[model samples]
Target: MRMGRLRHAMVCSSNQNRSMEAHSLLKRHSFDVASYGTGREVKLPGPSLREPNVYPFGTPYKHMFDELRRKDPDLYKRNGILPMLKRNCSVKLAPQRWQDNAADGCFDVVLTFEEKVFDLVVQDLSNREHKLMKTVLIINMDVKDNHEEAAAGGKLALELCQELEAVDCWEDSIDDIVAAFEKTNNKKLLYNISFY
Candidate 1:
């Protein structure tokens, strides 16, 4: 409704997977895109699932992968996280959290991949001191944390994003955008897949 390419922010529990995948897809479509996590620390497997490495947001994906690969090549390969991390590195500069987005930098729409993240972002937007955030629309479409699931979720997000960009909603309100988006897809833009 703000009438140009809608600025978007995709979020999940960690900036490592789902959000980053959606970020990559949306960015490819030329949407003003950013991604973030709601978690306190960046969580990723080191040598195994039982001992995940906790890192800061801006830590490079390659750096983490290299570290893990150095520690145990077989374990890193078996986890299959390396491929996902490799893909993520090609798109995003680094991992970040939802809190990294400033009030002044709030996007036109903030989409979450999980219900908990949707609630967290809703609250994050609500507590913002900037009134412009009132115009921001937040929607949650559940996506499991895996390669295929993230890819499918990213594709779905792209479709919904395209619909939102194409439609000409007269009213710039959040409700109007939501209504128009749903109307464009002829279905609610909610994806819940268990293929993972």
Candidate 2:
């Protein structure tokens, strides 16, 4: 039961589209927010479904944008990868892996966009020592990994965060907040309580 802005983390498979969109929106609202990927590497759509352009977690967004532009400017631009990379560059330097960010400090809430990412986050948190004994709310709201869906999901994430911030005792009020959010957004959210 603390009162203040809740620190948030938005996670997705690659942190290119969905997470970044939510991160950008949350940041705009002046929320203490960070974003991460659950995937082993950062992956962007390539010319074919089987061929995804992959980069290490630490690869700079600007570098990816340049490389993608050089590889096939028209293709990347048409697919929205270039624009996503451009937007990501403005939000953060690179995509970070969720498993590798344990030292980054604790977050009050972590919102993942997919069930697999939610599972990975839960598993990673479960393996860590509860040094702080601080509870973090991990919520998963399934959002399609696309530009349009990302935009809509970002708004919903913002709305949920607003509801959370309004409550003094979030742990006590979380169930109600989630229920109201689900009713309003018509989206089911899977949540877990984890310790830092």
Candidate 3:
């Protein structure tokens, strides 16, 4: 009964359309669909936490990286390969003046974090002079957006991470966010993180 309740709770936070379509597709194909959060309880995969696990880098990048490690090991590992020392540490959306500054042969992934997280990642990336790559991947996690879309957002699962939402709960207008993801093929992996 406890497990049953938990499963329902997990499902409840999923996208309605995506869930229904995925379930229907899986059933017809004799498959299954499961979901989870990417932060808190999750131990950063493969590689343990870096020396400064508690990022002054802000919440979004921290949570996003945590979630990435939980879901996509290879991608996360690639991320792990990037220069551990952040050069710059902040990002923002430029309206109209957005330019194509991306060059070739950057890191294995091209991405961005949300709001404050983006700011931190951008600042570090810019400071580094794109040492990670011509493009900097902003790692971030969605702790809120309690609405349908952000339902899969990672909640702080760490006892030490009690202030999960407090960190990543910023709302900003990053117009090219989805475009960046699509262009880079950087996917939002399942939140495999869990706590007993």
lDDT of 2 by residue, 1-196 (tens): 3345599999988758999999999888888889988877988899998998999999999999999999999999999999999999999998898888844968999999999889989988999888899999999999987899999999999999889999877999999999988998799999999998
Error of 1 at 92 (Å): 2.4
Error of 1 at 55 (Å): 0.9
Q: Which of candidates 2 and 3 reaches a greater TM-score?
A: 2
lDDT of each: 0.73, 0.90, 0.27
The window of 10 residues in a row where model 1 has the poorest summed lDDT is: 187-196
Where model 2 places Cα greater than 4 Å from the true spot, the runs are: 1-4
RMSD (Cα, Å) of model 1: 5.8
| Model 1 lDDT tens row, 83-193 | 777877888767877787544364666788888888877776666565432366677887878778889889888877776677565134446656665676454544221
Clashes per prediction? 0, 0, 18
Write down the lDDT that model 3 would get: 0.27
**In candidate 1, residue 140 scores what lDDT?**
85
**TM agreement with the true structure for every prediction:** 0.81, 0.96, 0.22
Two-way lDDT contest, 2 vs 3, winner = 2
